[model samples]
Target: MILRLTLAAIAFAATLAAPLRAEIAIQEVTSPGGIKAWLVEDHNIPFMALEIRFRGGTSLDQPGKRGAVNLMTATLEEGAGDLDAQGFAAARDGLAARIGFGANSDEVSISVQALSENRAEAMDLLRLALTEPRFDAEAVERVKGQILAGLRADERDPSAIAARLARARSYGDHPYGSAGDGTTDSVTALTRDDVLAAWQGAMARDRVYVAAAGDITADELGLLLDKLLSDLPETGWPLPPPATLNTAGGLFVEPFPGPQSVVLFGHGGIAFDDPDFFAASLLNDILGGGRFSARLMSEVRDKRGLTYGIGTGLSVRDLSAEWMGQFQASNDKVAEAITVVRAEWARMAAGEITETDLATAKTYMTGAYPLRFDGNDAIANILVGMQMLGLPSDYPKTRNDKVNAVTLDDLKRVAARLLKPDDLFFTVVGQPEGLTSSE
Candidate 1:
């Protein structure tokens, strides 16, 4: 009784001590041509970093064109405006500017950085890539060959195969189930028109949300944005509908010719906008997000001595997300490791988190939040991400409060919603002893 009271007191104290504060300040402005953006001006550095995210990403791939978006993104840098692949690379190297573009499962992002004195030229270059990408036939062929080579190489990696199998089994026919990079067949069939159409969707100003940080003012940034994006075709973007999670039953095994076995397990998880997202985040940390302090490390590695290390994460996809817990161990112990994982997952769902466990998870999440903004590039990237996700401008500031708000009850609820062992599509990609095929 006395111990129970002490624990209760501690929990109450933690709730009071580390409250979350979900405040992020954003300054919105309209470009001269009516293009809008969210800004957080900081004139501290002598460089400016800009990140623009398009509403749709890989999920926009049409049927039979599974790698269309991926190929388009890869092709964008091959040539743009008047610069062929080599020429584009030369110009980037000459300016000493770092420019990169990528597409994820849900959004396409372009990151550009240049010296403040050269913002005009940099923006001009960025605008050209965004608008008048050359997409030379030769460059497209080169990128396609490279992608096919990588896919073939990846087929030999057991860990990669395991991850692919996990998502494939979980999502089934969903776009997330397919490879982000196009397959040999898909890439071979891709045409120049398809790339152009994908590009058209990505460059729309309304569908684009630009975030700039570092050495630039709102007014100057606005003008630059106008100068860069004004000439682009005004085709409005229609984001692909969000993906839904499917937690159908049965384990999935991808037999591979390897010594060690890779295992992945989890089911439908929290969405970013779920009010219980903070609770889910805290739960993930206590369970596996913390490599050092998580239950997975302590039980799976320290006590059982099965694997070197294990970690889990809750990924917030373009709209929906999944909680995937993954690890690798010797083939002999694969079954045992899986058993322990399922048990712990059930335990978490049964409200097994103690006050101390909750406090520790919250502390880690809250304290580590600010580390995401340690550099100008990181800040610029996050600011754009926040906008894309429709999070409040003050999200960074108030993040801790939301994390602290997670109660034991909230954790239990989210855990139950997320941890579906029977429904979990476990994929093992190595030759595990005594592991029967679950296909």
Candidate 2:
């Protein structure tokens, strides 16, 4: 099955590379009720993929109710209207439709895929789930239990511990600092009323972004949007204030019994719409943005075998932005790895980059763009994300041009302005030799 999926993905990528890149068009559609969406019409396939994102997400959780939004979103499809949890699942399965609801710190997303023949039925089911989710006590407890179990598991996960601690230190008391899944105690304390209120506070029309692809016309998509989402509240809870990173350059060490220590290090990042974003992106690509040729991988892993891998990239969120990286190494070597990382960070901050690095990063980024638009589902998801990021519809066509336009001078300028070795904070989880907490 894995091999089959791999081949299917390759074929889909090939299709996108051939004619789709040149011919794909995005149309803006506004429903009669004034809700807007981006549509990509493709009649070649009889199925449509619709993606919707609500911006407030778990960040809108009421004070002392950290996990309410997450728990509420998870229970959305569990039961709604006349359908109980089991009945809802049965009805959805009966039509061979796919529907999913999920939430993270920044957004709550819903994705649905349905054949044109059964599209109406599928939409109706989705409408029921969104507009009239039945937060029955039984279903609520079941889902809450699952979330609690996950939280328990996360407590023992070294990576999860590092991430939670890093965010907590970075954002302080802001909502972004808290775990989206909440703590075991928070989930346990949740009541059904809290769940219902979370639905009201997080899911609403005003904060929604929509994208649709395949077997759907603008008019049809507009109508579907109204039918599925018109009943939601006009607005959700007020948005959270932007969060600022509070941790200055330093190391925070949490002692744990393990041979390997996980390190999370980062500093502030640029916004998505910044003019120098492309340059910053190329800089990151050359530094540690997933490619094996990245400086971090080549220097840390290939040259010295400090760890199996290492990477860094920009994380742009609605309320905050960060440039972060992570890697794990044996306790005996973690201090050396940190020394190497600090040297690289200082080097990059001093604008030590070459024309060769710029050209290579740009070529790889531009060449890999089309591979991301492999199918209707992928495209739809990308469209909604673009909308959320305030990108113009023509971004897809001009994105590579933007990447190609970055000059060696541009990269150095942005690197000097953006990279902050002095502001980088490290959160290390596990006992390591010769390292002390800067805190």
Candidate 3:
């Protein structure tokens, strides 16, 4: 009776403390020129931040024009309107504003941060960067050299080699198989014309997503957005179709001169729109997604002491989605590590989750979920991403409930469908002792 009373007192204290945390406010804005954006205002700070993303990412690269979009993003800041690279730098410093641009596998992003006192001038500078970019050749080459250096450096890292080989084996002949940062061969061959054409083809108003946070009113943001997106052409290029998932059986080894082997293996998984997505996320949490209280950690760390860490998740992109799991262990334990992974895969495939396991997973997933909305920038970013993925406005409010609703039967079904040990693609990098393709 005393222990029950103590537990009740602790629960009461937690309930009382929960209300002290602030909730994020989400507001949608549509510009006069029809550009829509999500906004979150935080008056606590004296500065504002704007983040915008476009749809045509690395997946949209044409055959021989690889890395063109990345080059465009890099060069856009070099010159714009009447300002060359040096002139633009002077202008930015004059207003004490910061701006940057980059592209990823699924989207290209532009971000700016400025003081509230100089919001208008800062925004105009952003407008010039966005709508009047010059795409200078020298700037393009400079960025290309930086990328080449990274590619060279990555070759020496066993983890990087393992990841690259895994994708190549999993998505053969598909654009999604290629690296977001183009290969050394492809990037070295790119020209100025290719960069310009890719910019004109990919960066369009129709494919844009905007997000802002800080000391700005709705009216100010509306006007700023109009000025920034005004020069975009009316139509955009059609987005390429989604990537295909290849589950054919294959294993490859990239023998790196290292003592450890970085092993990566998984198969096709569900899309974001799948009703089973929330359930699948919870299932992954139980298996290997969580840092603690996961099957992989228990088996690989606590029992065998093989590796220090393991991870699993859905690798979601605009063109494709896949279930991926990874681990690293010493060369001597590589075979043992692979065996544990396969056993866990088979165990999940056979639907063996216990009541205790399910309950623990649910608590980990739901209890920590609210932390994602702790700040204005995080909230704005989440809203913008959800809009791009076609998720509902109420997604954040209902996400935990959906996760809580996933059952043992749901996990069984998703696991059986997604976990394909027979068809998995394996890539092990480093000089693992006594390791073979068969293992």
Candidate 4:
């Protein structure tokens, strides 16, 4: 309990990181056994954060085991090797290490933090969890119960309803269309073997990426890497085929009891590797990238009072990408809010951006980028994310220049090509007034 409370307190401190703009020197280290990781040396602190990610997360679940990967990830900390749940917690807390595991559609992540003095022991503990997880029946059932409860609760959540419908309408038969948690039926039926399958399918060396920051040398990181992961299978299940998106525009209303409606909207989006991505990013900021100065917020909330908030983003996934947004409003106002959103989309698609809009977006994006590197954990996470995205290691240094080089004309040209006002689809969940399902 004491260590858990200490971790909870550390979370509050982590979030309070000042928006500092510091230069980061990143080095690529390859382990003796050929494992590669990105490292940032910060000797001022006697602590470190390490992040590891594996591609093909829950999407690797076998045909009949939709939620196996997610379930396995949750149960990783429950027990491993000779340790029971309580024993594992006691060992980790004794070393003052905080480790976490998580999964989504595209990737599974492991995060760890430990003081320099106990880094080796902490990593060894993690090694046991990764390579020899007990997956005891009791542990599996407990985590399964928690996931089942969440699935049941999602049945009535308007946001979840809109999200489910949106993905179904967008991705069709692909794995992206369904929930990562699977259905309550599928989860309840999962067995210990299914969880083991998920572990093998998702946690292999072939698809893993690693990064570390603070109080560790490149040589030390390299040696540690091989000790931590050399035993995993070299390969696992094949990745699923790409998702074929339905970009056709229309409104789909799900009837749920509520005075207000939740809506998700978007269409096809640009990919990270696209040459015009920087332009699309600046354009997204000007449109509805969640800032109060965004056009959607200004039109839908400030001027017309149709909704409390509305924003859009470039939602890129392993197999597909889409430009998406969400907002909530009174049932009577949902239609109006969407109308205003459509108008703004059309206006932007028509290349109607002003120089002032471009300047403001560039400044805000550039300034906010540095705030992401406030601590060792944040920097390590960024390093792994950049690797996963296939970005160049020097991206941090060149990123601002790319944003600054985007001229007003660049956004206008990219907006015209990227935004299809007519292709934007809306998924609304609730008794939205004046809204009827599209044919």
Top TM-score model: 4
Per-residue C-alpha lDDT of model 3 across residues 228-302, encoded as one tens digit per residue: 887876555567776777777656666777668898988787788989898788878888896667898889888
Which clashing pairs does model 1 show? Answer: 20-400, 20-401, 21-398, 21-401, 22-398, 23-394, 23-398, 24-393, 24-394
User: lDDT: which is higher, 3 or 4?
Assistant: 4
Q: List the residue pairs that clash in candidate 2.
A: none
Query: Each candidate's TM vs. the true structure?
Result: 0.90, 0.96, 0.90, 0.97
What lDDT score belongs to each candidate, Candidate 1 first? 0.76, 0.89, 0.77, 0.91
Tell me the tens digit of each residue's lDDT in model 4 across 293-362.
9999999999999988888999889899899999999999999899999999999999999999999999
Off by over 4 Å in 4: 1-19
What is the lDDT for 347 in model 4? 98
State in Å the error of residue 99, model 1.
0.8
Best lDDT goes to which candidate? Answer: 4
Per-residue lDDT tens digits for candidate 2, residues 87-165, read 9998887776789999998899999877677789999999999999999999999999999989999889999999999
Comparing 1 with 4 on lDDT, the higher-scoring candidate is: 4
In candidate 1, what residue range of length 10 has the lowest lDDT sum?
A: 14-23
Output the lDDT of residue 413, model 3.
86
lDDT of 1 by residue, 1-439 (tens): 4433543343334334322332334677777878777776655456667888877788778788778788889888777888988988877656656689898887788988777666677677777787789988888888888888988887788877777777676677777787878777888888888788777766566677888766788888789888877776676456666666776755666777766888887777777888888888888888888648799888898899989989988888775677888889998988899888888887887778888998888778887786666455666788888887888777776778878888877888777776766766677888888777665
Q: What is the clash tally of candidate 1? A: 9
Off by over 4 Å in 1: 1-25, 236-238
Instruction: Give the better candidate number (2 or 4) by TM-score.
Output: 4
